[model samples]
Target: MARDNKAMISGFRCLCAFIFVISACSIASFLYSCQCTSPCHDPGREWGQSLTPNQTIDLLSFPEAWNNLNFPQVPPPWRMKIAVFVKKWPHRSQAGGLERHALTLHLELAKRGHEIHIFTTSPINASSFPKYPFPNLHFHLSKPTAAGYLDQSTVWDQFQAQNSSGSPRRPFDVVHTESVGLMHTRSRKLTNLAVSWHGIAYETIHSDIIQELLRSPEEPQAYSLTERAVKVVEEVKFFRSYAHHVATSDHVGDVLKRVYMIPEERVHVILNGVDEEIFRSDFKAGKNFRRNFGIPKSKTLVLGIAGRLVKDKGHPLMFEALKQMIRENAKFRETAIVLVAGDGPWGSRYRGLGSNNVLVLGPLEQAQLARFYNAIDIFINPTLRAQGLDHTLLEAMLCGKPVLATRLASITGSVIVNGNVGYTFPPTLELLKRALYRVWSDGRGVLEKKGEVARQRGLQFFSATKMAAAYERLFLCISSMSGGDTENQCQFEDSSR
Candidate 1:
């Protein structure tokens, strides 16, 4: 009986291995097909070669001398009636990265005299529906699902009604969706629609792998490779329903064209941007913030991290690295301080390192976040997720603080362009430890200089104004194309002197 049971167990193991091999081969073949059939196969051309001059400006320098102009300051040649679809808006305490992005982008667009209409889920607190801050910005609220996501059917109904009203002789000049509006986009052909992909299933698969690899052996795995493969296939098909795609990072844009088979012309790469007005450097505010937190002026380095303190956000990497640093080096334990701003399961774990080493401040408001960024000498984002670029990293840089982040393509390719701006390490405890030690060895003055470099890069590429301007150009180009203008005429004119 024992011999028979052993044989059965061995047979089961063999069967599972066979299934995994088959699944992996299937995914590999699909990716190979993408590469063969897409522009990626062309040896003479580059990943973004097919993009027009305007679309490549963010990734490559402009041919002409460019001036850093604020989007709101530039008067639009013509006002555009725009419809935006997003899952949620910033209301009360429900501010996530996507919500903040939608708010920032639309606010800037509205300020520039664009008619902005937002279709989003109702606030959890029904009475918390605030009045519109801008006359051109209107909101069409839909009841949310139990999962707190927007009701797609309800949003579609509202959108259709607005289109049917015909108050404006023409329909919306351009429709923008922030990783939402799938129901509406899939239902019909909307020539002027642009869907911004914050993260795709292919990227999520990479994230899941990183999370699983980093997770402790005792922790139950949260992802199945087989399931992820299936989901990626489904996502590639579903994405084809949209007319245009906005990739939040260059790496993502590359993936959209090379792996997802999105046409290079249809994919636009725009890095995530932060509100420079709020997050810019302020030495006085930094000093005040440190004093309020009771951090001593003598502390050699004040390292900080903000955003959800969840495992996927790479808290485990920071927690483990810092804990080891304190345990191994008495000088580090005494001289360095880590400020953790945000709430999650890892909050208690971070606090477990003790108040002397790590200050676990709960989730902070935007104003407080600015102060937090200013207070820190160096910002550390040990995130494992390789999807969208974290706004916190950009915010920190805008506040003139350097970053030590994971070496993800999205971040390394865009945000941390060079060692002068910041440092990066592979997602491993040993590499992270080495990177942290380097930061400690370099000290404050060196890091501050790096921070200045990072701030300059942030202003040029990742500022909210820069982001809005890119979107503005894209919207106008899309509108022009829909009106039967030639693609060459849609080229964005650089108004910089």
Candidate 2:
């Protein structure tokens, strides 16, 4: 029995040795090769991981590259304190009309010396060191979102926390709101908060293309039927509700009243102004510019288009109209040159059509755009897609160019002079072509007459400085006013089905 016990003990010792060797080997392998929670194939880093391979990686914490719009111009000083809430401050979609208008408002307000704080997304393309220093103007980067739609919960929590934290901040005097999502939609009391409305949000949300465009992503967007139903509910429940709104035009104001049922008292009509200084240049056809851009300086009847490549800003109608103009109008054969400028999804398709007369010269940076503005004697904005007025039309008029915009842009109130400062037409190509021919007539005499009328009309009403002054009064009144009629505001939103 003693000998048997000794044998069992020896066997136990061998088993122990084997276990020790296995544990040590495991430790050595772990030290050499890291175990990653994430797999190698994940494209957007949905999960974090570690690897044995020594690699450098760069990531975008914010998805949108929005720093292209610079709010650098320092405003001198003005009395009213104003806070404007936009999705992104230095956003690049300046061609999107609203973004450009927002920048123009910011600069004009800052120049006037009004205390302005712009709450926006993280700016992407600013100086590495930091500049655009001004006491009057301030820009705050809102919290970024990892998830969209449902991500608003996190955004709200962060905003509420920040507001409560009170870091390097004073109470906001007035808040001018725009767009969907974030502050614009958040129905907080935010005392003395003034909402800025371009028009009824419902008008835009119901468009067929916009509905389809939202789902046209490469990845599965989780955009099922239930999600869309929830979105519609949320829009109705939250977005349509506002304390007050400043509509940029009377037509839009009427829509707010008739369509959205917003009260007249709650809706204020404030026209957007064009900056004559920036749009109107000596524009003396810089040397070789007319030739380099493929045009004759003297006799060539140049028609310029400068806006987004979106189907909404009326590009399709304009293209079709140009086609009609060239095909039918004999006079266009000698003098007509269609210069379409700007960039978008439809850009390649526009270029691919390869109409010899229609030169899709890609997009022009603002400076380059100014030269093109000078190059053309006539301007066309066939914006059938969106409802708001075209700032480009204002720019064109300031450049002493005749414009042919749709009747929808009747909001500008500057498109016609006894039906003369250019002309108005429906989105139909027939109307657009007929109007274009009437204004330019493939002749210098008619172009000069129409151009002069356009410039005069622009000077009469579209000056940016004047608009800034209007906003100053608005800011002061809104900030100083207490006990706003919230009941009326709610009643209007509810009734405007």
Candidate 3:
């Protein structure tokens, strides 16, 4: 009996040792994945992971590299006290158009000597994302919901208290609210108020209807009639309020003027921009990029698409079009492959489409994304519902990849002139297929030439520097009209320190 007990104890010890080893290995693998190190050393490995510590430091220190967006030289910089209110800010794992726009614009502004106070729910964890030193920039972090949405009450309470009597802090020169953060507040009593509108509630409802219509026979409806109506009313009511509005694209500006009945003068049309230094044609494209994403290198034509895998993003249309092509066109079926980046609720259904060639690479970091863009021959944006301008399209264009996007949106047509940067198709499987086939048959030379044009156009118009400068000019215009400070100079303060 004593010998039996000893044997059992020995077995338990061995099992515990095995478990410890497995856990250690898992932890190491995760750390390695998140580590910022050079993985692909070859210049030809454009999609290779080459994030060295030195490169990161250089990216941070070099103003020219960071602000590659071209702008006319200004006299001495004007410093303004700017309050930027955002519901969400980008982090390592999560980001969208709104976050990217806010970050890019604010960073450039900070570089230009403006003091910025960011009131946001999405604060980067210090362990995960090291906070870069920006002397004039301060973060007012607030607690958010489990799903990452901000608790607006915190922001409102802070603002009210700061504005209330007996407060030591001075009032902000200008307040720039993003999305519906300003809508939640009762007081538009601030000296100068501006909103960076990405999309209003009506566009969301419109997208839902399109998605439901595209659903399969057995698929359940995504929204109810009552919900749609309520959202429209809420959105219209929000937009109807008067303030200086920053529209991300020409299409969005029209929506503000026509749908919301905002005065034409109040609407500021500033197109969102890309960081040309990070996303450029200099990166060499090769099989390594494909291997990084588990994509086959030998495919004749590689197509890439990135965004949330949601109903409105037109993933359903893309899947259906690919299925039809596979059934009807033999050449496309054999030679073409689609590489998908990003993850969402509809991801499983997308994978269920079951084309062996369609590879879905879940969300990737910016560096990883640049590589992915280089690996692909063509970038596809089949977004049916107009959601202002998509940053991915600009990023792809900056990387010298031609985009085939839908013509429905106001921005896509403006950016992608047919036969110039890329071809735009109507939101239909037949139209999309034809465009795809046309590009495939036109061969690599046609795609490369169009991509070169795209790079030039992107640099000329959509640099982050240009977008930031436009916002600064708008701020000055609004400030001057308000009779506040005609000089439009920023006052730097190190409040966060």
lDDT by candidate, in order shown = 0.78, 0.56, 0.68
lDDT of 2 at 444: 59
**Cα TM-score of candidate 2:** 0.68
Cα TM-score of candidate 3: 0.76
The regions of model 3 sitting more than 4 angstroms off are 1-76, 122-130, 145-149, 160-170, 221-230, 283-287, 291-297, 345-356, 486-497
lDDT (tens digit, per residue) of candidate 1 on 376-442: 9999998888888789999999999999899987887677767888899999999999999899989
Better of 1 and 2 by lDDT: 1
Q: Lowest summed-lDDT stretch of 10 residues in model 2?
A: 59-68
lDDT tens readout by residue for model 3, 363-468: 9888888888988888998897777678999989988889988775454434664567888887767888898889889877889899898888787667777677
Rank candidates by TM-score, best first: 1, 3, 2
Arrange candidates, best lDDT first: 1, 3, 2
Pairs clashing within candidate 3: 78-490, 79-489, 79-490, 79-491, 80-490
- Stretches of candidate 2 above 4 Å error? 1-78, 91-95, 123-133, 146-169, 181-185, 199-202, 205-240, 281-288, 297-299, 328-330, 352-356, 409-418, 440-442, 483-497
TM-score of each: 0.86, 0.68, 0.76
Give the winner by TM-score.
Answer: 1
Q: Which ten residues in a row have the lowest lDDT in candidate 3?
A: 58-67
Clashes of 2: 9
Candidate 3 local lDDT, residue 255: 56
